[model samples]
Target: MKERFRLWSRAQDASPPRIAAAKAPRAAAISSASRRPALPRGVRIYAVGDIHGCVDALDALLIRIANDVKSSPIRNWRIVTLGDYLDRGPSSREVVERLIKLNELNCLIALKGNHDVWLDTFIANPETFREWEPWGASATLVSYGLDLVSLGAPDRCAALAAEFARVLPREHADFLRNLRNHYVCGDYLFVHAGLRPRVALRDQKEADLIGIRQDFLRHNGAFEKFVIHGHTPVEAPDVHKHRINIDTGAYATNRLTCLVLEGAARRFLFSDTPLPD
Candidate 1:
């Protein structure tokens, strides 16, 4: 028997082929060639979590932000998504596209999650980013409309994979061009994953930056700046003063969350919106 696989979507959501009827976009999504994000006075930073391809929820997250934010003299704000932008949901392609659009509009700092590194490494390693083995780690292929169930039979899957091979998003490829590893501030270090436990920052490796979680979480380690991150999905935004894990696994739950802060104040904003499987 051939290796059997099921697509993540159901009939109501539209099959991969029918979804393929509307291929993923490859447009040059970078809007304004702006260099850096503006850090204006009284600015608020909306640090977001793992989107997991739920564009609708992301839109709602921002919409809630707009409605809730009171009008003021200086409304300079930043939208920082904590990586894992692709995979595990129905709209990974759409999420990336929207992020590109959002980046063009405001100050956006998209960090690199472990999944991102996996995808990027796959893309960079041509042997891994091909028809026989296109990108499909933890539901990326499904999110990109290439899951076997959606693509049909084995032969049909191969053909569709070949076609997807042709239409990979240039914008997404560009989006992964130079993703930042980690960010540091006065009180904390913002990372996609987390830091190694009981280790000094100077001794941490890039892999440790986006790969170590259990060790960091289980072990008792101290840091100069509290680490704020996403990737570990808990019931809530995992706010514990020292390290806050904000990845609420947005793709499946549809209940995406965010972490908001103004200089010293730390608060969280979340949106509960159901999405297509």
Candidate 2:
């Protein structure tokens, strides 16, 4: 299947005229020299930012992505989610389930975010709850039908872990455990957080992949691949020559963003409008 995707990506390189012909006048102004990095020829990617447990936004965003793809009809497509699939919002459990379902389609690539790791850590040792709760573990506990008070009790670490083990869906556990730190597709690298500056991609410290902030963000140097990441929240997608940040703080701002990439063109689909319950 991956080989098929590669072949398809290569075919897209030959049809620049078709792609250009479809571009709007405003987009046509994008000079060839200034064009954003291109994906492999036939491959298209829809990369979503930190979900932060906003299942409603996630659901709506998936609809928007589906509609966008349906209307545009791109083959060899893949969906890359920049993680933080749990916490902060009202439906962490549901968000995990939704991603699990999406992964079943065989095209979804999920990365691990710090919040996700925190959840796992808290589950194994509820003593971490003191810090985790304030970081948005309360909503995750509530979504799991667990009592925040009970789980947060000073002496209940073992009990909490046991309880969670009994009820946590195997599927969700598998999904979380199997998540990657980063994904490289064509010329873009998808990660939950930023990468360390001056380090080879292979030599990167794993912690920085989902935790680094100031250092990575401050560096203006170019990376081998255009890094697309989302550990840091932003009011809007930060598009730069070397990287793109799409985390729009969905848990609080109600905006879940998806960055779409086809050849060298980039666009976005956002779910900010509230969906009626």
Candidate 3:
């Protein structure tokens, strides 16, 4: 399995077509009555949306980010991935491996997404494979060298789970276990999914942090901090007065998004040309 992963990684290392960066139209003009939300001086953030196991797209975006930094350098910067790094795509194991490698260099802050949580649960309780199957869990299993044709039976779930646990690298398990629920920096709150409206940051539940949808999406009121998140897929990066959604549904659309924030300004980098808004 390890040798297979290495070969896959090498194959993915071939250069992909260059991605472009575009400035998002400003969401709103700053009013004299209220201060614009800004990161602390010298800090810039590159927050990536749900990966969903698209390793090739992930590779392109990371290269674009590195190029962006070279062209416009900042001493204090971060790459925060708004997680969903598993399932729904063919390269789930490779995706985790790539992130784990980046993390070792201290260049990434990976948050937990709903699909990622499913992986943890599946590991502990193989019975949950029944629940995860519809959400591309089979793709993930295949990524780890599992032959679904042989293990696809409902009765084989436990055997499949045991095989997965045995084949999964210890480091990969450690990476998933240690992923953060959310990360706060200056005025922006980074989460996998949107936070629950009206709930204090300290009081927000993990369930809501990874899964809340309509309540977080429909709220027009300001959050405790301006939020940057991904879970729900948007055709484009949905920029509102209060938050930004960057998930472009990589697995299906092959378009991944990276929301670049510096001071109060916002722009985007894409793994492929963004679909028409």
- Which scores greater on lDDT, model 1 or model 3? 3
Q: Quote each prediction's TM-score.
A: 0.71, 0.84, 0.89
Candidate 1 lDDT trough over 10 residues, lowest sum: 1-10
1-277 per-residue lDDT for model 1 (tens digits): 0011011123114321211111111222212123212233486777888887777677667655554454322356667777887766677777777777666664578787766755555544434444323333435655566656555534454455464556677777778666777776555577888888767887888787876778877754456567778878765666553667888766656767777766666666666532224
| Alpha-carbon lDDT, every model | 0.62, 0.78, 0.82
Better of 1 and 2 by TM-score: 2
Q: Against the true structure, what is every candidate's RMSD?
A: 12.7, 9.2, 5.2
Better of 1 and 3 by TM-score: 3
Q: Name the better of 2 and 3 by TM-score.
A: 3
lDDT of 2 by residue, 1-277 (tens): 3332332232222321111111111222222334467889999999999998787677667766665666677678989999898888888998897778678778799998988887567776767877776788768877989885856644576677678778888888888988999999887899999899989999998799999999989997788788999989887788765888889888777778899999988888777533233
Worst 10 residues of 3 by lDDT: 1-10
What are the runs in model 3 whose C-alpha is more than 4 Å off?
A: 1-33, 273-277
Please, what are the lDDT tens digits per residue for candidate 3 over residues 62-114?
76677678779888878999989999988999999888877866778999998
* Candidate topping TM-score: 3
